[model samples]
Target: NALTPPNFIKSIIEEDLRSGKVKEVVTRFPPEPNGYMHIGHVRAIFIDFALADEFGGRTNLRFDDTNPAKEDVEYVNSIKEDIKWLGFQWDNQYYASDYFDEMYNRAVLLINKGLAYVDDQSADEIRENRGTLTEPGKNSPYRDRSVEENLDLFTRMKNGEFKNGERVLRAKIDMASPNINLRDPVIYRISHTTHHNTGDKWCIYPMYTFAHPLEDAIEGVTHSLCSLEFEDQRPFYDWVVRECEMEAQPRQYEFGRLNVSTMVTSKRKLRKLVEENLVDGWDDPRMPTVSGMRRRGYTPEAIKSFIYETGISRSQGLIDIQTLEHFVREDLKLKAPRTMAVLRPLKVVITNYPEGESELLPAENNTENEEMGIRQIPFSREIYIEQDDFMEEPPSKYFRLFPGNEVRLKHAYFIKCHDFIKDENGEVVEIHCTYDPATKSGSDFNARKVKGTIHWVDASSAVPAEFRLYEPLLGEDEESEELAADETNDVSADEVDDFLKKVNKDSMEVVQGFVEPQLKDAQPQDKFQFFRHGYFNVDPKLSEPGKPVFGRIVSMKSSFKL
Candidate 1:
């Protein structure tokens, strides 16, 4: 982490520590447990944990579960798992709901100070009156209610005396302020729903803007780091902390968020994909979610390295997804074992070889990693090669397989295609080739040279597998389409339909393939580099005994340079 380049946030923290403005650097990763964490959250997680750890401070994992209508325990558990998976352990775990009683008291204190009031305006009515950027908002009719009356009404609201959204508590801020967020923003709303953590303990819920600062102050958080979108909300954030008169005042800082090309990081869009059965689930490999990337075989080291390389900045830029993929390849190059997996299998028969015999051939597990040593691969009379490797009618410079052409079978022998059998539909059903004993692999046979070499798996002992190849979920043209900038934004039905239309139909392709018998026992999450097929991870959810499913993490090659 010391190698990480110093950015503005780091400089600020250093100044704060040096000037004694802060006794310690305490940060918190407060995510609402309404959905799964995605790659976009990686930068915040890194900054929070790394900066706090570097300063010998602590970081807390806090769930901002203010909106119980969308929050659930299932999402909370998934978030915790994701943080741990990213190689971070929180100093303490807390939830906003834990301080509901204290938060209520703080709201009451605001009411007593004449800084807040209860509003009877409906949500739509409030929105309609809350003016646009060019105009000032009109004050609510109930904004002038006396402190005692507001307190009584707020208490009744908490007692579930009103239906959902019938009333809300608003701060006594300027309605004519240029900043829309300062226009007497709703601080609390009546929601008669059970919270994931608090259950049916209360019907009134504090809004996120109000509960966030309170939670930070209650936890003694020194710095509350959030994305640039919250930069405008900082005024209100400070207002809540100052007006509520919290014992501990936590300052808010904003940094640009990480955005990837062609990735939909919005939780609403992601949820729609899952809810509508457009994707396999939240952990679908094509998704940009942390759990999805994990299932896709991305290593924690790769993700961390990518975030570090991106660094901290104030400009929100779209990073090429290939840049992230480059890190995955770098991390996996030496770690994953090299093996052969024949996707789209083409049966090849070594007609001249001993019909019923097979032999073990020596193959290095990883060419670049000597410590991996060697592995024995079975070679028999019949084997499976990739279908695209061969061509009955060849093209120029094609160096894989063709009729009457000799090509070295990787880790095996020199085999020359002689004949091919065709089905009634004129499809090539099988290929017949003959192997020369004198040209065995690792031998000093220089008498004949083959212009091509291809990889294969012994059909007799191969493990049948399902291969899932993936592409970007959204098409290139759709990449620039604007989505909800914030995760909490509500997406309309038309928006969902328009987004779905842009989804690439060919995002994933499934094919039955065969891998070397050595991978027969490959467990879920086990990673490997298939010869000519890039890297793959065993599908955790779909893979079963004897028929393992492999998801292609990335291809064998990329034009992307770091």
Candidate 2:
């Protein structure tokens, strides 16, 4: 697993390198500046940067900003931050709109060469004329227009003479081509909206299919790598480069995209989650955005290692979300400090021990990492253990604290339960126990051992905190579904409703808890592994001075093996 396995695209790059087909490799991550980047983008990001780096090459961070209606500066900044947080740096940053003048001139060149023509057909009319996969499409009525007239009209259209949907520029490719993408796909459409970068300098914008190929060519990108979903668009990509006659030709190769089993990667569906208030924002901890994972306590090293383990393959299948959690736990085992946190507090009074007194008990920071050293935790006569740790009438074989059973307090002393109190609702509220000072942990004395050890915090010194436990964000994982509605270039209202229905309403549960006093100065993003709980990150957004909100990254135990 040390060396990356061979895949189709990697083979192609290796072959290209061996035959001197390329000297230096140049790749680009051209993300559309429309929405926040998600985990799926991490795969493409890894592929683009890793492939180029393998060959001593460079990768460019380019924003395909052709559609101005949905793009904004916020998405652009988030994308950069996500990439940086992912630990990959781009050699250069460029926007698709940066080459608007050249794109417009290229449109004019296509017109002059009779390879393009401006059509007056409405969008619905064009769709109606564009035949299905089994049927041949008919040419536009404006297909036979003279080159001079088409050029004049295209210039006027660019000059804002025509309203949106009134006209569009189409490729002069074969209308009867078996590949429907080659059936005179519209290359440019009129949009009156101002671009985030270009402002009102241009109203006629090039389509993604048209602008993508040209952008790569202009940047001298040698290899354009992307997901297999774009395989069909490769032909149109080649067409624009060949017909437009660019100096540099970036060959496109497709690989299977990374799809986690229990999450949605569709941008539109994710946008729906944000707009419908089902999620806090694009970076909501439940959402699968890179920022979401970061905020949820996922480390860059862990994420990168997880991707490396997933490998670069052409036949990616449904990756279990547990696999990701596995890597997260593995990375934190030695790195994150081992600490005790009582999530749901159950007051325990040491009736026979010294009352109104607390003692400092030595606790190891991490058993696996001794170099992290040790810290002393304050243990009081009236300490707080997890509410679930004590069952007044536990079932068979339950060795935890019961009416008469004894359990060891982790890193402290063995405590025997004597009595319990209940509220009017018949719910157990308080417990009475007696701690044997001779049985204190790390003591040179040995006594009778207990099968159960539960974590607890000092009542007087424990810092109050909030614990946020998260589950699968969606109730229905994308089982065999191949593509999101957006991939088909359409998302229906019914589909949105159905996706919304699958959202897990119980995705998050917040409860007040107590942590060791050492966490009093724990700043945002501090990570810790709680005994019997899970790895947690200090919530950067909701954490306040002396009171932190911890987001559970993953539990300590897992059924996943590799």
Candidate 3:
């Protein structure tokens, strides 16, 4: 159980302890309970939990559930489950809603201190008062209210005495600062909505920027870990904690968020895709969500490995999605059992084999884990090969089936195509091949050199299955431009809007196929390599008894034909 060494965050924590920045470190992962956790969240989770683990500190799982309008118990539970699945335990479970009463009292304290005020102006009017980056903002007309009047108004605002968004409690910070967040940010606003946790206890709620630092200070968190988007808001975060007069003000650190190419991680956009039926659900195997990756058969070890290999860098960059797929492929290659499945089946008749006779062929279950043992597959006269396995007219480099070409039926015997039959459509209906009786696979077949080996399943022994092939969910050009925008270098607003319009339309394709008999009883999440086919995982949500649904994980090679 050797632990790996320091990323920038861990390095900082180590140095902090050496300098006695407080005896031990404490970190917190505060995710808003609005949507499922995605890979981007995993990066923060790993850094938060892993850094704590390295320094023998503690990590808290806290839900920044201030936005009750979108937050739900469903999302909260999903976040907890995903973190546990990633193999991290929370030192304590807390919610921003848990401190609603305390946060309200703090707001009252700010009003009594004349450091905050109740503004009756509309949200738009407030925006107008807050001038451009190059100009100073004018103060609110009510900015000079007596402390007693402000406290009374704020108390009424909390008591459900005002319409939603009619009034907001604003921090009385400088309006002329270059940082917009510091221009008297909204600490709390009126919202007549029921909270998932508190349930109709209050009508007003605290905004994220105000609640987050208060949460860190209350929990005694030593390190407030967040993404780079929060970099500009760092000063406001520090101000809130300081204004609260906390003894130990938690330090905030920012790092670039994780981005994967060809994948959209925005919750709003992902929700749009789900609501528009662009995908089956939030857990669609092609989605970048943790649940989606789990359904797609990606192992926890593979995800952890990808996180480690990507490393923690302050410079933001878009990671090639293929890199993540490659780790999954490499990890599964040494673990998953091998089987045979024929998609787009083509009939092949072993003309020389006795009619009504079948043979048991030995096949390796897993090449990397021999102790997994081998399984026996039924081989018969009539078999099904991939439709693409044969070409009626052969190319010079083609090593597979043609009228006179010889190839090995994997794990069985070498067969030479002698003839074929065609239907009225001129499509090859069946291929006739003669087996080399002396070259049966278990005997001298291993020594007989062949240009190609193709996978086949016994026609009568094959089990019906559904194969799901996934492609990129965004158009090539659009995805590239979107990636550029996310890097925050530069892009026109028109380009941004048009790129979002090209969201993936044909992201999923389902087809009927046949799998080996061993797969008839396969359970959910069972992973396997379909011999010459790609790696697949049994989809738990769509799979049924005797009717397995498999999602293609990744191909054996980039040049894979089927």
Candidate 4:
């Protein structure tokens, strides 16, 4: 963590503190509780918590629940869990709805100052009038309404007298401004839906843009850090705090949003994937959600380390997802116990070894971590090796278990394949081999050298398990096309359909396997390095007593380096 590169945001915070421009570096992670937090949110969460903590300041966990129709308590709870799991705790917790009354009062103040007006334009009409970047916007006919009439209309709208979108309160800003966001944006809209927090107490809700700045000011947040997409709205943010006469002004700062290649962080797309049964749920191991990564055995240390290394900047760069996997591997290598798990198991009968006889072999839990000590693995006459480990006709350089070729069985004896059994379909079902007793592991039997080492589990003691291997849900090329088509994040139904079509059907593959008996009691979330296979974590949601399910966290090798 100390080696993480310093970011411009940190420099700005230091200068602010040094100049007495900021008394304390109070920040907030305000997430709308509409969906689970994804990997993309990790950047914001880290910046908010880390920067504040670095300055001996505090951060607040605020739920931007202004959009009651889309928000839910489930998302709120999940967000909190994710933040805690990442090892950062908020100094205070707040919700945007908690200050709805205050926000309404502020709107009233704006109306009183003749800085806001009631707009009766239809949503379509409003959009049409809000001209493009090349043109200036046209003022609403209702924009110049008298202060008294505007106040009465806004009050009536809040009283549930107006249907949803029938009326809205608009800030009376410039219509001819080059920045279209300053063109009298809608500040409030009538929504009759019940709020998760407020219930039926209120019928109208403040727009997110209008409510966010007020929430920051009310909470005394000194720095309102957000993604680059919100940079265009910073002017409105400042306008709200200043015109509303908020005693505590929170300045807004923008940082580049983290984007990972081949990752879909759009909440709508994620929700569609779950609803359409394209994925198991939000916590599917293949998902990019924090819960998903956690369930897949990604460590908090790895995620935090990834965030630090990625750093913060004004340039939005597409990061290779492998960089993240690199961190996970780095964090897990020494911690996870090493064990053998034969996926696609092929029964191997050591004909020369005595039948019904088994012995315990000592194997280091982790070669690099002697502190983990050693674990006893079962070795027997009959054992299961990876099907791919043996070949009747092997190519050159294939040093594993070809006929007459000897290979060391990890933690056991060197075994030489002599013959194999084939099913009626001519598929190799089993292999016949002979183990050299003199070549037992830990013995001083280096009479000859073997070119290959393979891993296996004792057939008698191997635990039946399920291994869930994963690939990226979206291919890199498809993801690039999707991003190019949908830059606004406002996905349409057709776009969703097209995106779903691009979902990799083979993203996940479940195969029955055998793990060493030492893993028979492996609890959910327990992590281990499968010998010559990959790193895996016990599936928290599916693993049951005596029937463990392991999700491959990452492969054993990666071309990427940190």
How high is the CA lDDT of each candidate model? Answer: 0.89, 0.87, 0.84, 0.89
For each candidate, give its TM-score against the true structure. 0.95, 0.96, 0.94, 0.96
Model 2 worst lDDT window (10 residues): 479-488
1-562 per-residue lDDT for model 4 (tens digits): 4323598878888899999989889999998888999998998999999899888899999998888888877998999999999999999999889999999999999999999999999989999999988998998999889999998998899888989889989999999888777899888988889888999999998888889889999999999998887888889999999999999989999988788888887888889999998888999999989999999899999998998888888777788888999999999999999989999899999999888888899999999999999989988889999888888888888888988999999888999989999999999998999988999999979899999998899999899999999999998755432232111345778988999999998999999989999799999999999987789999999999999999999998742111
Provide the lDDT at 262 for model 4.
82
Q: Which pairs clash (backbone N, Cα, C closer than 3 Å) in model 2? A: none
Between the candidate structures 1 and 2, which one is better when assessed by TM-score?
2
Over 420-510, each residue of candidate 2 has an lDDT whose tens digit, in order, gives 9999999999999998888888886565878988889989989999999998777545532465212235356787788888888889999
- RMSD values for the candidates in order, in angstroms, are 2.5, 2.4, 3.1, 2.6
Candidate ranking (lDDT, best to worst): 4, 1, 2, 3
Model 4 residue pairs with clashes = none
Q: Per-residue alpha-carbon lDDT of model 3 for 1-562, expressed as tens digits? A: 4244446777787788889876888999998777888888898898888878877989999998887778877888889888998888989999889999988888887887778999999999998999888898888998889998898888899889999989999999988888877888888899999888898998999888888888998999999988887788899889988887767789999877888888777676666667777787888898888888989999888888898788876756888888998899888987899889998888999988899999898987887889889999999899999889898998788889988899988888899999999999999989999988778776854555888889899998999899998987874433422232111223455654564578767777888879999899999999999887789999999999988999998777664753
Model 3 misplaced regions, further than 4 Å = 1-5, 442-448, 476-500
Number of clashes in model 4? 0
Model 1 lDDT tens row, 1-562: 4734588888888999999999999999998888899888888898898888888889999988788888877898999999999988899998888999999999999999999999999999999999999999999999899999999999999988999989999999999999998999988888888877788989998988888989999999998998888888899999999999998989999888788888887787889899988899999999999999999999999999999889888778888888999999999999999999998999999999898998999999999999999999998999999888888898888877789888999988999999999999988879999999999888889997888878999999998899999999986545433333232555677877889888887899999989999798999999999987899999999999766899999997752111
Error of 2 at 410 (Å): 0.9
By summed lDDT, which 10 consecutive residues of candidate 4 come out lowest? 480-489
Worst 10 residues of 3 by lDDT: 480-489
